[model samples]
Every structure is written in C-alpha cells, then in structure tokens.
Target: MSKMSASNLKLLQPSPPQDGLACRATDGALSIKTVGKIYDPEGVHVEALRDCSLEIAAGEFVAIVGPSGCGKSTLLNIIAGFDNLTSGEILLDGCPLATTNTSPSPGPERVVVFQQGALFPWKTVIENVTYGPVVQGVMSRAEAIQRAREMLSRVGLKDIESSYPGQLSSGMQRRVEIIRALINNPKVLLLDEPFRAMDTVTKSASHQYLLELYSATGKTIFFITHDLEEAIFLADKVMVMTTRPGYIKKTLAVKLPRPRQYAMLAAPEFIAMKADLVGAVHEEAVKAFEAGEREMA
Candidate 1:
C-alpha cells in the first residue's frame, strides 16, 4: 500500500481518550486564529508567520516541526504569551493572549522549557526548581523546598537536589529543568527542542521518561522540534510549517498506538507518515528558497 493509504488506515483505528479537566469556557483550548508576525520592517522585514491557524485540544500532545528558521520558536513564544502577534490572535482555552510589546507577562499557569535547560547556575537543583513557587508566593520556603524534593524524586534527581547546576551533566540538568516545569503543574508545557543536545541513547531514555511524566500529569503539551522522527514519536498531531514566512503547510495526525515504543518506528504505518511529512517539508523548503532568491534580485 502507498504511504498515505497506510497512514489513513492507521487513522481509522480508535485510540484511547486523554484524561483532563474540562477546559474553561473563557480559555476553549489553545488556538492560533489566523496569526501572523513580521520582524524588523526594514531589515529583510521577515514575515515569520502567515495566516496560521491551529487548535490543540486540552491534554493533547502537538508537535510543531519544520526546517530551522521556520518560525516554530516564534509561534511557541506567542502561545506562551511572550511575543505579540502582528496580526490575528492567539487564544488559550477561549481567552485571547494579551501581552505588551515592551513587557511580557510571566503567566502563572503557562510554563516554557527552553532548549539548553535554562537553570540558574548559582542555585542548587532544589533552589532552582522551587524558585517559581517562591516568586509567585505559591508556598513558604519550607513548603517549596519540600515540593522541590518531591519533584526531584519524581524526575529521578532526588540525590542531586543539593548540587548546583554547574556540578551536573547536561542530561541531569535537563532532568532538573523538567522537574521545575512539572512542579508548576502548568496548564500547558511548551518545549523547544528540550532534548536536542543529548546523545541518542540518552535522548531515548529521556523520551520514555517524558512519556511517563505526561501520562501521569495529563498536561497539554506544545512541543517544537526539527527532528521528524522525534515529532512522529511524541506528538498526537504534527504541524509542518513552511521554510520562511512560516505557515501551516500541513498537519498530520499521528494515529500510531500508544504508549508508543521505539519498535513502532519499524511499523509500515509509521514509515508512511514520516514519508508524507518529509515530502511536505521538502516542498515548502523549495518554495521558500525560490522566494528568497526573488527578493534578493
């Protein structure tokens, strides 16, 4: 069977329902309604996003994947309420995401886990993980420390809680950062290539750990990665963006069964979906390259 046909067959199969509280009427679920963005009106005036619309149901795992510079990061920032949209709107649950051009809000319910594990170098693992709760008055120092310890144990970093970030390996630091994000009990977890730096074996282990964490927490996740295989493995739906002036070129629903294992990669269905996404990405890349040439001429 052709790849697309195989993918369709997989889609027809029923998957287990996700568990979560009903989203508030004010927030509907996370969505980008005809979003667009332009950076620096003079210097290349890059249209980072164009007429992109997406809706991610509560507790869903959606991955945004494309070539580098496809504006995936910008979209994630907008969803996190970090960047303002030039046009259109981003709605969470059902409410519009509000932010100022000069000062962005560090929303209490939304958390972003950046690449390279953005932890404080001076603080110990426990201190860094508890900082959010401390700053937000979510708990007393003693309570926060206790919460931090619990989270550290959950992520398998309990013994390293007293160690500073500089004292840990990159993988260990990522564990701490993930625990920090988890400790917030965030409504949405925005991850941008969070495991891109790890070795394959380490990445695989972390991937399994993440799946287990998500299974237990049931938080909505918006993951961004350039790795097609990673996107295939992790997301329920994978959104492919154009190379530049990024738009949703295509959105592929992953019908693969879960909890998915590495062996799923060998399935005919998995191979087909990957091929379709790869083709879509290549077409967008070619179009973007041609457009760049025209502008330069």
Candidate 2:
C-alpha cells in the first residue's frame, strides 16, 4: 500500500487514553468564537485574551504569530483543553469541548509537540516512539514497533532506532520527535515553537522534513512561532494576534504552491507576504512594549 493509504489505515486505530479522558477523534476542525480568558489575583482582574475568534478547517495548516505576552499560548492552551475560556465557546467539528474546574482534557485528537524536547534520555529512538501506544494498550508492543519503524523510514531516518537521543544530533532528535507524534495519527498537531532552540542550519533541515511529512499525512497543523518566514513557509494561512488581551488582528493566506520549494522563500511574492506579516506583528509588538513601560512606571 502507498504511504498515504497506510496512513489512512493507521488513522482507524484507536486513540490512547489521556488523563482519564476517553479517547475520541475528530477531523481537527476548530472554531474559536468570541473566546475570552481572564485571571484574577488578589482582586485584580487581568485579561489575557478578549473576544478572540477564528475558524480553522480540518486538514488546514495554520500558523499564528504575535507579540510576546499577547495570549498566544493562552489561546492554544484553551484549544488544547488545558484551560477554559471565560466567555465564548470552542467547538470541534461543531461539538463543544468540556473542561473541569477548568482542568485539562488532553486527549488524542490534538497532540502538542512542545518547544522543549520531551524525549526520554534513557530510551532509544524506537523505544521512545513506541512508548505512548504500547503503554496505553492501544497497540501491542509488536504493532507499535512495526508502525514506529515505518514512520521513521518514511522520514528518511534510517538505522537510528537503537540510538539514544543523547547520541543523535539536535536535528535528528527533532525528526524522532516528529515521528513519535505521527505514530498516533492525531487529527491535529500542535507545534509550540518546536524548532526554537535549534541553530539556523539544523532548523532549516528540520523544516524540510516537517513540510514533507505534512504533505504526506495532510495533518492539520497549528504552529505557533515568532519567525514570520518560518510561519509563512510552513502554513497555509498565518494569523497574527494583538498585544496583551489578545485577539486575531490580521491573517495572510499563503499562495505558494505545494511541494513548497526553498527558492520560493526569496521570491517576490513570498517577500511581500513576509512584509505584510511583519508589519501586522510589529504594530502589536510596539504596543506590547509600550504597555510594559507603563506597567513599570
């Protein structure tokens, strides 16, 4: 069977349990409508997000960029079920997600690949990749290993199954992490600046691998990054957020053709898109800086 077909078959596999939550799946469509998040400390009310709204279709790769402390993480956390929005509702495939005491509901539909590496230092690459499925009993040990190996091979990561993360290059470790994420066939992949710590060269290579995998799997990717170019290059649409009490301030649709090429990064159209994103984000950044100054005063 073709890789896509195999992936489709894998998608039928059951999702593993998470935090006592029953595993369920979706096409990864997200609807963020008039969402608000507020925190109260010592009778002081602080708003992290206010009236934020967005519509993300299933299988669409969307990237978000914004000023520091602009509630980007807050929004992602809300969508991930780690927290609750004080106002509005988030729907998955038109059904609402439930939260407790506003506690997390991290299930299998959305998986977060964090900025910091979460790999086990003591485990081999294959071991780490197979860990989740095996532990959850969603897949037998043998089944998980077979799928994990296939995923690694597809990413052009060969013969490193026995290598420890400590022994691999930074870029290679990232590839392993990506493979680990895919073995679950999650409807959506949440990347929280997963490449932030890589050096330029390593980051570039990781980007290529990621784009290729995204094409093959057609997973809905919600990427959060400060690098505007990286966001544009990786996402079908880029959404920018306002400072402090965050909301979607602007969005740019990337017109670049699929099987995206590195050369396109230097193309005029790409440059123009980047300029637009930079301008939108810059205005918010300035606003954030001014807000900080006032707080200090």
Candidate 3:
C-alpha cells in the first residue's frame, strides 16, 4: 500500500469551512446516513445494523458503548472500508465510501487499531513503527527512522527503539501501534477496544497517554468500548447503540473539562452522567439477553 501523494493529502484535509455551524461543514467530517448491514451465512440471515445514522464533526472525539453482539465492531469495520454497508451511505469529507469506490482502499486516510497491538515479533520497535512509511515508499529508510524517532520521543518511548515487541510491556506495545498509525497523518483514527486486554493499572496509564496524544494532535477519533467509565472519561460525546440490528439509541454530550483527570471520575457531575448512561446501556443489555434466551428456547 503506497502513501497518498502530498497533493492528495492536502485534498483530503482541506481547512474547515468558515461557517460556525457544525452540520454544514465537511472538512475532515464523517457522516453515516441511515446505514444498515446484514450477514447471510449458510442461508441464515442476520441483521447487524439498521437505519443507523451519525455525523461526527472534524476533530471530535466520540466514544460508543453498547452490550455484547451490538454490532459495534461491524460498524467500525464498515467505516474502515473492510466491509460494505447493505443500505445507505458513509461519507468522509462529504464523499461516499463503498467497497467498489475508486478511493484508495483502507490506507493511511483512516486507520483502525484493534484490541491486540498486532506488532511483528521479529521487528524492533522502531522498525515496526516505520514499516508503513517504508513499505509505501513515502519515505526512505533513513527518513522513516528519523520520523519514527521523533514520534517515539513524543510518546516518551525514545529509549526502546531497538527493542522487540516481546521485550516491551503490553502498554508499551499499544503505544507503539498508536504511534505507527499516527505517523501516517491519518484524518481519522478508529479504535476497537484497544485497551481491553490490559490490566487495570496499565489501562489507566494508556488512557492518560491517549489523552495526551489527543491533546497534542487533535485527530478525529471514533472509539468503541464496553467500559462505561472509559467511554465517559475519554470522549467529548458518548453514543449508545441498541442490540443486534443496532442503531444509535442516544448521544450524550459530555461537558467535562479538557485535560481530564482521574479525580474527575469521582465528581458528582461525572457520577450523574455515568448513571444515566448506565441505565441506557442496562436496558439494551436486558433486551439482548432476552433475545438470546428466546433463540435458545
């Protein structure tokens, strides 16, 4: 996968419109219009999403939370262009994204980071980080190395360039994967429970690290997590989705201040917001559970 040329990069990231209205702007914006997805395996059809619609403003950090089997991962996959929508459309910068589109297939413009860091065991930290740029011929080996070092330093991993993935802690490996994605200057970053496998302490550290990274870069992010606290703490807006045949149930605006701290979780305001989201998610979970029981019966 080659990198987009400098001109193409500029075209993808035009400056935001002068209008103050968020809905009318398209620069770096993502719009999903009444999208639906269905899977038919062995002639049995299953609907994953139905009439789901959302619009994310440029540079917004949006987190989604829902019960298991709610098609969260499916939605993320569609946005990453790995899968196609069964109905409606997904537009980035007001341009539709489809599996058949001539637009470059799932390259640096939008990158998805999965739960596992997925680093190569044989490659050193710097090697893994620079792999994309080098493979794409976007930069020479020396230039890629230099760029990787700068990013590593920004994330405070300057000393581990030569170390392999096995030598670093799980948290460090996650950081490396994030840096690798960011090095491409992607317009959007999609995270699918990237911290799910980490211990509590490590998860907390990664949260802080991610917050710092977001502050520094202001990249658009769409994060999916089952953890309610994590969703509220990290996002400017929390979107809750219903069970299978999922559609967004509600979108909650988080008024929490920037540079959020762990202490904020204990505040009354934070607790109230969490309680509201918890109620919404609990309802969906109950519905999902009942549906499962019916299938078993």
Candidate 4:
C-alpha cells in the first residue's frame, strides 16, 4: 500500500498508569499519561482518544483491541511520533517524546510497521532492510548489510536478498518490512495491524516468526489488532479499548506458555481468556454501532 493509503486509513481511525509496573515510565520504560487526540475537519471537532493511559515494560508485547474507529491507529501514530496528542504526554525510557519530532527524523527511537508492508518497490530486499540503519548512520554500509542478511536468514528470507519487493509474495514482503524496522534496533516497535490482511496460514506463520524475533531481540512492542485470538496468542498482555473517545477498558494477562503454538488456541485457558475479551469488545462494538447510527440520523 502507498503511504497516502496508510495515512488515509490511519486518519479514518491504552491503560492506567500505575506504580511498581516495570512498564511504568517512572521505571524508565514507556508511559502514556492521559493522552487525548482531537481532529477538526471543516470545523467539526472529533475526539478520538480521551484520558488514555498505559505503561509497557521494557520488553513487553502489548496488543491493543477496540471497536473500529476507536482510535487504535491514532494511538499508535502518537506513540510513533507521527502525530501529536492534544492532551497528555508520551514518554520513552523516562523522557517525554516530543510531538514535533516526526518519524524518520533525528532521534526517533520508535519504528512503525503498517498493515500494508511499506516497502520501496524499487529497492532490493537487502537494500530495504538495511535502509534505516544506513540513513540513521547507526552502522557502516557493510555492517548493515551483514546484519540484514543475518536477520533475513533467521526469518528464513536470506535467499531473496537480491529480489525486489515486487518479486516477493505478500507474506515475504511483510517479513522484509519487519526486518527493515528491526534492523535499527529501535527501543520500541509499533505494529498497526500488520497481519490483518494476510491469509490465515500466512498470518499464523508471521505470528510464530514475530514471537521468535521478539524473544531474540527483547524489544518492547505495541501491536494493534482487531483479532481477539491473535491478541491472546501473541501478546504478553491484551489491552481492550472502549468505543469512540477510546480509553482502556481492561487489560488481560495471557498466561499461556511460550514458544506458543497454534494448538494453544484450543486450550481451556486460552479459550477462557478469549471469552472474557470477546465480551468486553462486544460491549464497546455495540456502543460504536449505535453511535454511528445516531450520527447518520
């Protein structure tokens, strides 16, 4: 997908801060304090988020779920420094993230992977993977290529290093995008429904690959997805958001053991967790649907 499409999709669209949590900004991790976002389109003010707060531990994987248009993407954009929050602050490792410093700019410690793999079609796979490190001057060209090749091999994509993005399958392309972001070793990785468009088998494969990468890298990740099962299967904690003017409704811890497998989805604990989350999400979904109906009327 083009950058324009990604932005349009995002424009069309977490938790309470507490002490003692390793994710707490006070503990030198990621923190969100009463963050809010509003948009004025043609004099109509739309509130997207309200008093949203959440803290993620240094290496925690948190998956956020909410009704469509609940500002899940908006939250990700703010965390990524792509957009400014109207109210509240976001801090990374105890430092507030400046809203004015846009991404791919200097001193951005976060990288985002959109639903559509944002790859430069003209650049070969290796070049795309190494782009961030090269641009950020994080490593020399030779070192970047070496690191990219190693990451690709770890994810089983080493053989396609010379191919253009157009030459790879959708799944492969997504993996390349992930490697591209990961190569920078950013402190945080923001994923906006990266697997939503893939086939089930492909999505499942991507999930396992991501878990492996997360285990190896220990990078904190904020993942947004509408899939309840996916969230439970992949995240250390699953955060549910309410309808428009989104806020954290609940946070559920997934106790399933890792090296997680698809089979675990059938386990009693997994099913129970999904049941509770489904109930929470359904309540907000109803509210969102009613709000839309009223708006049309």
Candidate 5:
C-alpha cells in the first residue's frame, strides 16, 4: 500500500490546540449556581449537568464523584472555561469567569492536568515541564530550566528529566503532567482523573503525594473521579453527582482527620461514610439510567 503524500495528509489532520499557556494569577474561589448544559439543537436536548451549585474555597481540596456519563468532567470543563453554561453562572471570587473566544490572560493560578497527561512526545521531560513557564513568559531561559528541574525533583522525577513521555509508565507520565501543572504554582488545580491509568499501588502513592502537595502549597484542588474510595480518601469535601444530565446529589464534608493512613480505609467510620456516599450516588445513577432508557424508548 502506498502512503499518502504529505500535502494530501496535511488536510486530513486535526488542528492542534492553540498551545496557549495559562499564567498564575490570584485565583478566587469557584462558585457555580443552577448551572445547566444542554447539547441538542433539533433532538431531545441531553442535559449533561443540571442545576449544579457548589462553592470551592480558595484553599480547599474538593473531590467530585459520580458514575459514568454523570457530567463530572463536564462540570470541570465548565469551570476550566472549556464549556459554556446554558443557564446560571460560574464566578471566581465574585467575578464571572472569562469564556470568550479570546484566550484569557495567562493566570498562573489555575491549571488543569487532563486525564491523558497530554504531553508532547517529541519534547523531553524537562521541556514538557518547562512549557508552561516558558510560554507564559514568566521566567528567563535559565530560570525556567531551574524551575522545571525543581518541579521534576518535587515529583520524584529529578533523574528522569531527560526521559521522553513514551519511555515513562502511565503513573510516571502523570507525575510529569502534574509537575508541569504545578511549576506555575497554580492556586486552583483542576485534575480530571489524573490517575485513572495507574496501578493500585501507584495510585495510592500518588494520592499521598498529591495530599502533601495540597498541604504544602495550600493549592485548592477540584478533582473528578469515579472511584469512591479515592474520593473518600482525598477530599476535605466530597461532592457526589447524579448520573447523566448530572446534578449535585450530595456534598459530604469529610471530617476524617488529616495525615490519613491506610488504616482509615478499613475503619467502621470510614466504611459507613463510604456506604452513605455510595447510596447517595446510587440513587442518581439508577435514575439517570432509567431516564436514558425512557429516552431510547
């Protein structure tokens, strides 16, 4: 079989992300109220999220948990300025979020580490980590290099600065992505299942590391995940979402003592809390499934 010519293949390729880098700015608290999203013009409008209202404090770690297709990712995207709300509003501190087509000024305070790591394969680890600071014009070449190295060390990847993404494991790749996100000292870290591909052991370790990062930097985190245990372990406040056309089913404050350990997972209090969350989420999941069935019918 003959390969397509470069000229012919160019047109078939997808356009790359505009390669904009977010800078660090004072990230105000995130507030969403009665926010709804509907994605249909002529068909039955499918609501990905409905009337979801929540407030994440400037330095709190909040975990969003729900079943598949529950709009967890959708909600995160809305806050990230990647999606639009059909009704209601999202505010940062008190200012409405910037969602116009123009790339907002790079605010080093809010950074998102997508689930896929989304690293550039051609770039070495140092380059990948340095991309954010470099693009934001925050540091000189030498300064950015030093900052990148420091971030890599913080993530336990100091010796692997020259490694390529393809050479690292899924967990390692995630660390690189995280370090890149944090190099700018973002105030609010939006993580969309950053550990979905890791092994259980790796996940646990990464979880602890993340908590340490949270405590050390006081960086507010809005994390989305389907794993109940993971949410239970990490969040200071766990927000449960209903299934499709998701809504906030419940928001439970995890009063579990911090500096947590594995023993907490096996305790009755922990188990009870987990059960309560599961029950709350289960109600929404079932309702969502039935709604889908009715729509199909």
Candidate 6:
C-alpha cells in the first residue's frame, strides 16, 4: 500500500502497450513441481491432481482450461492458499509457499478475483477501493484516497468515485474490483472466471479494459476458465489439463503478436490455436463425461 517510489517502478516498455498486450518485467515468478492434491472427505480419497508441473514467468499471463471436475479450481485454490496440496511443492518468486511436507497459509502476495462481483454495495466506489489498505493501516486515508483516484483515472473511471456499486455498469464494477486488487500490489492475480457471467457485449468491453490494465501494470495473472477462446485470447500460454486426477496434458505458446486485437481472432494463427485447444480439451471432456455416466448408472 506504500508508494512504489519512482525507482521501484520500471516501465518495461517506453510506450504504452498497443494491440492489447502487457509490457512486463521478469520477476514474481511461480514454479509448481510435480504438484498433487487428494481430498479425503470421509476417506473417499478423491485424487484431484497429480504430477502437475508448471512454470509461470513473473508478469506473464497464463490461463488454464479443462472440463468440469478436472481439478482446474483445485489448482487455483492451492495457488491462492485456500486449500493445501496433498503432495508436491509450489514456490512464488523462489520463496516456497507449499511443499510436500508442509502447507502454506494465505498471504498478501497472491489475490483472487472470483466470477461474482465483490464490491460492497453500501460503499461508494472510492470507499470500496480504498478499504483494504486504509483499514489495514498500511496507508493513511488521504494517501489511499489519492492512490485509488490515480488507479481510477488509469482505468477511465475517475468520475464515479461518489457512485455506489448498485449504480455502475457491470463492466465498470468488475474493473473496480481489479483496481482494488492492484492497489494492494500483489505479485500475482488469481482470476477464477471473473468474467464468465457477463453477456457478449459486456464481456468484450471488460476484456479490452483488462487487457489494457495488464499492459500498464504488468501484474502476473493466473486465470482459470472453461472458455477456450478466452484463455487463448488473454494468455501468454495456455495449459490444458486432463480428466480427473488432472495433470497438464499440453501447453501452447501463443505466438500471436501483442497489443492483441479482435481482428486477430479471425486470423489463421488464432484459429489454429483454438483448433488445437479444442482437440486436446475435447478428448479429456469425453473421458470425464463417460466417467460421470458410469457413476450415474
């Protein structure tokens, strides 16, 4: 919540990012090694994850997609420290957060944005955004108000400080939630389908808003989604997980140029990437569906 001081903040790109891509520094990295999780509810021993290894570069955006019950949410929860991994190790920026022998408690370095709106309806926009730091005493109310205003201006919501969450458009409300998270200066933003509930038009607007925010701040993002297009569109890399007892089935590097644009969606590169993802995920989805059917029978 303290000021970054000019030296602590470095602009990785001289010019603001165009084409909707973030200009990021290479720190705040994440490493997951042979990660595994098993739920022992009544000793049912559900193996939710296994042998899952991932390397996420600091300031890079990565998305993970898989069918239902494939441990997508489990992995995100573990990264956010809401759940303990039964086995494996996780390190953030080379600091161990979780290992095979111990559980990691939640900390400020990671923050999550869920699909539902989290802004306090009773609080004005400015109040909601400033509550975290100001309440924690990390910053004086005056300083937090100043910082929140600057963040609002960056996201083009400077005029809405007096407005309540009930009045802002859904897209604008989501942006505020993001600003609230960014104000805390977390190392990674964990998004659990934050835009899944929006309609097409609203989602499109929010997508651009988020793309520009990511470019400007260079915050590393770990997104979990069922939407294949959303994953490929926003991530530097896309990871596809297998059926239950999930593991990384494939990882694709998006070679599409940064400063991303909707037109790119129709390009051969985008189409090819989507096709590849569809194939990989569909295979696993079929397996998951069959397993479910057998259980029902």
Which regions of candidate 2 deviate over 4 angstroms?
A: 1-26, 42-44, 98-102
lDDT of 1 by residue, 73-114 (tens): 998888777777788877677776742343446575778888
Ranking by TM-score: 6, 3, 2, 4, 1, 5
Report, for every candidate in turn, its global Cα lDDT versus the true structure: 0.78, 0.82, 0.84, 0.81, 0.77, 0.84
Compute each candidate's TM-score over C-alphas. 0.86, 0.88, 0.89, 0.88, 0.85, 0.89
Candidate 6 C-alpha lDDT tens digits along 1-297:
122233323331123323554434665699998999999999888899999999999998999999989999999989988899988889988888888666667765687887787899999999998988887677789988988888786667889999999999888889899888888777898998899889998887887877777876788999988899988899999999999999999999998887789998999989999999999999999999999999899
Per-residue alpha-carbon lDDT of candidate 3 for residues 1-297, written as tens digits (9 for 90 to 100): 122233433332323323643323234578888988899889899999999999898889999999999999999989987787788788888777643333425777788888787888899999998998888887789988987887787667889999999999999999899988887767789999999999999999999888877766678899999999999999999999999999999999999999899999999999999999999999999999999999999
Shift in Å, residue 58, candidate 5: 1.1
The parts of candidate 5 lying over 4 Å away from their true place are 1-28, 41-44, 98-108
Per residue, candidate 2 scores C-alpha lDDT tens digits across 1-297 of 013344543443434545666444347788888888898879888899998899888889999999888998888888877777788888777878643234558766677787888788999999999987887688899988987877777666668899999998888888888778777767778888889999988988888878777876677888999999999998999999999899998989998999788899999999999999889999999999999999999
Between prediction 1 and prediction 4, which has the larger lDDT? 4
RMSD after Cα superposition, model 1: 8.0
Error of 5 at 73 (Å): 0.9
**Per-residue lDDT of 120 in model 3:** 89
The residue pairs that clash in candidate 1, if any, are 26-94, 27-92, 27-93, 27-94, 28-93, 28-94, 29-93
Residue 100 alpha-carbon offset, candidate 1, angstroms: 8.8
In model 3, which residue pairs have backbone atoms overlapping below 3 Å? none
Cα error, candidate 4, residue 128 (Å): 0.4
TM-score of 6: 0.89
